[model samples]
Target: MTSSAANRRTSLSAFLLGALLLLLLGGAAAVWALNRFPQVAQLAGLQPPADALVPATQPRAVATVPIGPQPLTNAVPVDALPATEARVATLEARLARVENATSRAESSAGRADALLVAFAARRAIDRGVALGYLEPLLTERFGPTHPQAVATIVTSSRRPVRLDQLAADFAVLAPTLKAAPESDSLWQTMRRQMGDLVTIRRADQPSQRPIATYDRAVARLNSGQVDQALAEAMRLPGITAAPAWVGNARRYIAAHRALDQIESAALLAR
Candidate 1:
């Protein structure tokens, strides 16, 4: 009888060991699947959605008065912000991401939308140096007119800077399919070929007829085209200072390049 009981116990232990092995194998498979499709929240239990997850919610449209009895200008509306500590914590985290982005241009364009989402994120503006770059994008993407764009930028940002650009690559393919493509499908395809949008290529260089111009130039002084930009700036109607476009060219013209933050500052000044 003791031997019989021992045999029964042995059988139970073997069964448990087999079950444990199966569980381990299943877990390994799940890890493999999860690594490939990161958006899947469930491990082989659910069908994955077709689209990858993007944070939903277009930021609520907010207006900054460019002109009013009290036009909002670099003013903190912290008093109007909600008083939830959790929300404040979330904002602090987001601000950290903006502060840590790879480049100034990237940080500005990538972070503006998210920053504007925080109802009172504007107050945090006093803490960093992103405002100058952020404004132009917010204005171009959201506002209908330059004046409105300018006003929105000036009022929303704690740091106000200038806006300058020689060419803009209005994505020809990007215009809403709801509109006609003829009016849309052209980008001097960018002086774009040059790479930076803040740098201006005389949209039409002595055109016999005309040229459809679309482009955006950004900093170096491009180093590659600094000499060219300088020559052109010298010829402009009545401007003396180095244009961001020319500065960018000059930057790229050399082996090592840095407009010394001049690109961003120049862009903001524009």
Candidate 2:
């Protein structure tokens, strides 16, 4: 054999030996890495060694406690709930009553204030102040054409009639006639006595005098003779002396005097 051919054969044999040794060392490292970290070996496309691979284990049975019937929770007594509800209802009713009473009191106070204001305005009208000053107030309280307003005007404009004297006369006459017994004759006698007393009282009564005087005064007032009207109003006897009628008579006289004063002032100014 030639020397060159002998050298080539020696090189080929050394390469084969080196490759075999490298393959053995790589296989050992792969097995070791799979044992330490199997996920890394899997990512690298390496299979686990038979000793490193383990079969899956069955799940262990869990120890369980027996579930007996649960204990009942304590509940509120049914009777106690109704009592609490009733107490709440009673408090609500009491609050409603208090609110109603407060409303009534407020309404009464408002009416009293209105009455006082109306009385003051009436006084001013009688004290020589113009009726225009009081008209608005009266209209607000009672409408312009209301019966109450008309009555107030009429009562304030005229002297009061003394009818109380007639009541006294009737009282005196009443005792003169007795209660009749249950007999036709007694009843007739009692009727006769009553009739006689009534006739006498009627004859003595001066009832028409006040009426006549009031009519005269009203006529004078209509005729624009306020002075004459006041004179006629003053002639109403016993009206100013009677406590029941005096207040109204005074109011009427004051109104007349106010008109007279205004007229006198106007004439003087002219």
- Per lDDT, the best of the predicted structures is 2
* lDDT, residue 120, candidate 1: 23
Highest TM-score scorer: 2
TM-score of each: 0.19, 0.33
- Per-residue alpha-carbon lDDT of candidate 2 for residues 1-270, written as tens digits (9 for 90 to 100): 699999999999999999999999998987888779977877776766555567768799999977997766786677899999999999999999999999888777756655654555445544434445455555454443243543454444343222233234323322221232334486676675565454433755533344455666556655545456556655554334333333434455454454344333323321
Worst lDDT window (10 residues) for model 2?
Answer: 170-179
- Give the poorly placed runs of model 1, Cα more than 4 Å off: 39-52, 55-270
Model 2 Cα shift for residue 150 (angstroms): 6.7
Model 2: how far residue 106 lies from native, Å: 1.6
Estimate, for each residue in 43-138, the C-alpha lDDT of model 1 and write its tens digit: 444655545355667889898767657766987588745666668989999998786764665756645543442222233232323455555554
RMSD in Å for candidate 1, one decimal? Answer: 42.9
Measured with C-alpha atoms, the lDDT of residue 174 in candidate 2 is: 28
Model 1: residue 224 alpha-carbon error in angstroms? 99
